[model samples]
Target: MRPMLLATASVAVLTLVALSAPVRAADAPFNRISTFNVVENLPAGADPAKPTAAEIITYTEDGNTLIYSDSPGERIGFIDITDPAAPKAAGVVALDGEPTTTVVIGSKAYVGVNTSVSKDKPSGHLAVVDLATRKVEDKIDLGGQPDSIIKSPDGSYLAIAIENERDEEVNDGALPQLPAGNLTTFEVKDGRVVDASKKVIDLTGLAAIAPEDPEPEYVDINSRNEVVVTLQENNHIVVVDLPTGKILSHFSAGTVDLDKIDTKKDGVIDLSGSMKAVPREPDTVQWIDDNRFVIANEGDWKGGTRGFSIFDKTGKLLFESGTAPEHMAVRLGHYPEKRNKKGIEMEGAEVATFGDDRLIFVASERGSLVFVYRDKGPGAAPEFLQVLPGGVGPEGLMALPKRDLFVTAAETDNRKDGGIGSVVTVYQRQPGATAAYPTLLSVDGPDGLPIWWSALSGFAADAKDAGKLYAVTDSAYAQARILTIDATATPAKITAATVVTRDGEPAKGLDLEGIAVRPEGGFWVASEGNPEKKEKPTQNLLLRVGADGAIAEEIALPEAVAAQAGRFGFEGVAVVGTGADETVWIAVQREWKDDPKGFTKLLAYKPADKSWGVVRYPLDKAAKGWVGLSEVSPYKDGLIVIERDNQIGNDAVIKKLAYVSLKDVKPAPLGSEVTPPVLVKSEVKDLLPLLKATHGYVLDKVESFAIDAAGNAFIVTDNDGVDGTSGETQFMSLGKMN
Candidate 1:
């Protein structure tokens, strides 16, 4: 087989800086240990659909317990992390209003509670909860709703950002609304708040965007009791001395010029776009040291730069990261092309000193990843360490150096949306550690940029090479293409792509789901049919394409079988034999209208005879959703079939591999008087454990599975093209499957 050149003349090739990153391997790096779902902390008879979130998480003083805000549930949930590998629910403390942030001072947890009646009249309080009793001890009435709360390094003072946020729908989310936001500071004595010492520092006339309505989004206190806050919408940053209650300094967070960014949302990731003078509407701000700080330019109504910036204490620009981090996300296939308006959507940041390293973590809310970098002090560019998957919508991040741990609160609770609920993910650090994620990646194309690919629906291993494989993308994109992957590289890489063309042009309106390489040359592709709609309903098609990717033949289902078609048609294809005697097998995704309960079909066709035959395949019963087959690969004894349920996360019951032998097999011709025979299948491996090992909930699609030339089996999950999903792709190899 000839190697396909993935590089194109359109985009510049990008380097994998992460491959040779200057990582501090002397100590073990942080790797996810466990995931704790907030739903487990719900009380008995609680309405599960009432949407709860685990946002703004913080560790207790002892570092053994975690407290996270649950705004929708109107409570703060606790988790015992004494054993970092097995986190336990420590129960939740109910609150009168929505909790936005929490910080542990001694044995009491100070929480920012928002009790606003409406956008016009924002109201909230500072709720002090006793950790031992799991009850609110006191509630200090704050004049407005609170967004961010933090304590001094010495625990002598507490500062909060009274956002009094503007409603987005109100005049298209423009600023300068009434009931302006301000900075509030209070004195703390013996872990108790002094009510009389509470001072409200009016932070108006600071930013050029909306000087009157200064919406303070986040606040962080440095070692000298100095507070640094970010006004995201107004694109401003301010520094205030907590002891004197005096404004120390202020400046606009400013704009950034971004290049090599994918700006178009045209169903493809083309990193040739650029944005000039894009506002760095920062979200979260943190101090790397008393002399410098970092900002996550998440953007709001105005702008988003798709990167991070570092600035000196006096507002001097130190270092700028244009599109480097977000580009690395693209290398890992986490690029959200549909969300190109803001790029990766940088949302949060956290800084902490661990051992000999002062690490800074920048969170991408849309990409579901946290890019870790080592701060090289002031004036020098920080070195990129590695990127970690931050679950789904990792809104809040915290690093616990005292316990050598890192945690993130993923705020997206998709239970109501047929997805997994919110989760608090834990990661542990040990010396000389190796990274685990990004099991698969794409290498730089000829133009230096990584080859862009997503929605990997089907896989086929190279017949001659042990680590070489071919993958097909679904109709997520406009064109149908085949990707060649070299699994020999660390974190297997997609080296090239071939567009499946018809009459020398890219195929249109085709949802190709499966591919099987021909022993002679080229491939046999399968397109899953959708016959539910009346007009332009797709038909399950089997196409034969040559080595050049030009369509040689297109076969459709028989009239009798096509008449009883359902939404799910062909999902996977595998070929046995060669030339004229070559027999092609197709796996139907779900039970068709003609199939019986818990039974789908393994369809067979002969290229020479042009005859169609079918054999029944039994499915495992699902507890909540339907079960179906995803892929079919011929193994030594029989065919290895990927069987899974439509459910996701913990609701999933059947994601396994079932084998069926062809020793006594004879598929009856479809529409014939003879009875169709059922293949006897036995379970070989249960895949639930492998999916759970990633410290994320079980994904719904275990779509592609194949045995390589060395008899090594591999599995990959589809990310739905990162649309309304976390964009976390799992490509795992289970060693050899004999």
Candidate 2:
């Protein structure tokens, strides 16, 4: 047996686990302060339903405003961050073409507008707009499509990557398709471009993979007026001197061998896989100093190393992050199991200095997080700082050290799926402040790997332990398992995991949604089922699970009653009394075919007599979407139930805890045709305020609630296992319920 770790199982997991300890004055951490929805900045007459995104972001010299490119909206959006804690929509500047990237110089914003007629005939221009006037000042044609643009530290030069990007549909997106790309540069004086100084440094015939087509992806400039470019598809890096417009050095980004990673997208987080010599097709590049730079290995084409790497100006490999960041995401429950081929998919990078400390921030496009690290200078190891949660598909990272702030642009909007939309998330660093997010985490198992867990749908407190609880994962993963949680820890640590097994193997086709501890040292769990599922229909079931996690018995609804069940079946399970009076109760999520409009079922089964009964539970009216019961637990003299709407973010409502008295009320027979008596309920707590206090978004599933032996009440939200979600689990204590 492995010793339980109060913090993390391994040193590498400290990136996220370190938040479990107290923070010192010097180690003051960054915590998210606010989120600004991009839709709020849409133009006056534009359709509000149209999707918008904050792809690439930059700030003015005063750091009081943010400018981001909204490619889908074909515009540039602004945000007022004068009060970093409360970001407001300043407005948006409509453009003729899609904006790819934007950079601010003095009081003007320079944007790379892609007006490509076709992949074979790439065309774009640099649009310069006066920030104060909000008018386009000038547009310089570059004769190609621009992907990334940047300004020199000395404010004397601007560099752009003319990426004549290839169409993936064209010959399977193979190289040498057509015209090649080049490095475009211009001299700047007093915030205006010197057009006569325009120089195009051909980047063709350089990469070993495709000498004829070099698709320059990202570019960054250092203080010395030197630009670093990453040819992503070609798997190469190039260094160019701005003043001379000369290509000084270039090198292959190369390949890396990865181990202990999840390689399949089979609805499981198995990290025992390996990849041999995979391409490090890098994306964004940033300079830590004049001597070294870093690249996010996004692996857009064929390979992704699953991390970032550092290189010297001469193309010498300085450091490779390997799988440390991926492991950190796993511990934080941010791992994207559906897109496991590239893991977290590092796609954005930023470097800045705050006070006396230099920091490096890398964005995970798929994981929806930004990884922070302290740069220990060149040739030394960078210390992993902490990870920050973003909205969804965080693509751009910017650090405002002067204001002690960091901002991320999440480009993926999920409103069509009833999820969160694209937004700019802001975080602030304060002295002696601890990390406020990641209220839950998983520790290392006996195998020395962080136990992967998410979609926490049900919870049950220990019979005697004050701070110990048990939780169950739902259909988010293929395998159903019960996890042990130490609520005493600052971020409630998941200490151990036990697979819910049947016949000596992991249980299959189980969506365990609710759990309750039994009086005789076992557990009663409810598995929600959907008969409408065409692939493999499932039936709602009640399982008697021993302490060892093996199923001892399974109970199903009678055929006559089960025939009336809908897709939303059993959601929560609870046990009451003992011996002959032991009654197992299950909460049905929504109205079945035979139920009344606003009423679902609360099933009761007596193990002594093998009899079943049912009572009706009235559901509150939803402001929008549908309202349903998510959980039920024994409380005081009645039951505490979690009722919520299926809406997310600002549209969410009805996430509340309600109590119902079961004193003297008798249930009708399981298959009775008569209307069952309804249970009277009263609102105990409005959980919306607690969910909003997290500063991310109002998650829809407030699925678990339980009270410990010491009278402490806890609530946890299910993240749906990072599938089409931000992968954020909010585990909080409601204190003692009155």
lDDT of 1 by residue, 378-468 (tens): 7457777777775678989999999899999999887877877888999887676678777777877787877788788999999999988
> How does model 2 score by TM-score?
0.96
**Top candidate by TM-score:** 2
Query: In candidate 2, what are the lDDT values of residues 142-200, reduced to their tens digit?
Result: 89999999989888998999999998898998887678888999999988888888999
List ranges where model 2 is wrong by over 4 Å: 1-26
Task: Give the poorly placed runs of model 1, Cα more than 4 Å off.
Answer: 1-27, 534-536
Query: What do the candidate models score in CA lDDT, each in turn?
Result: 0.85, 0.88
- Cα lDDT of model 2 overall? 0.88
Weakest ten-residue segment in model 2 by summed lDDT: 1-10
Question: Per-candidate TM vs. native?
Answer: 0.95, 0.96
Task: Tell me, by lDDT, which candidate is best.
Answer: 2
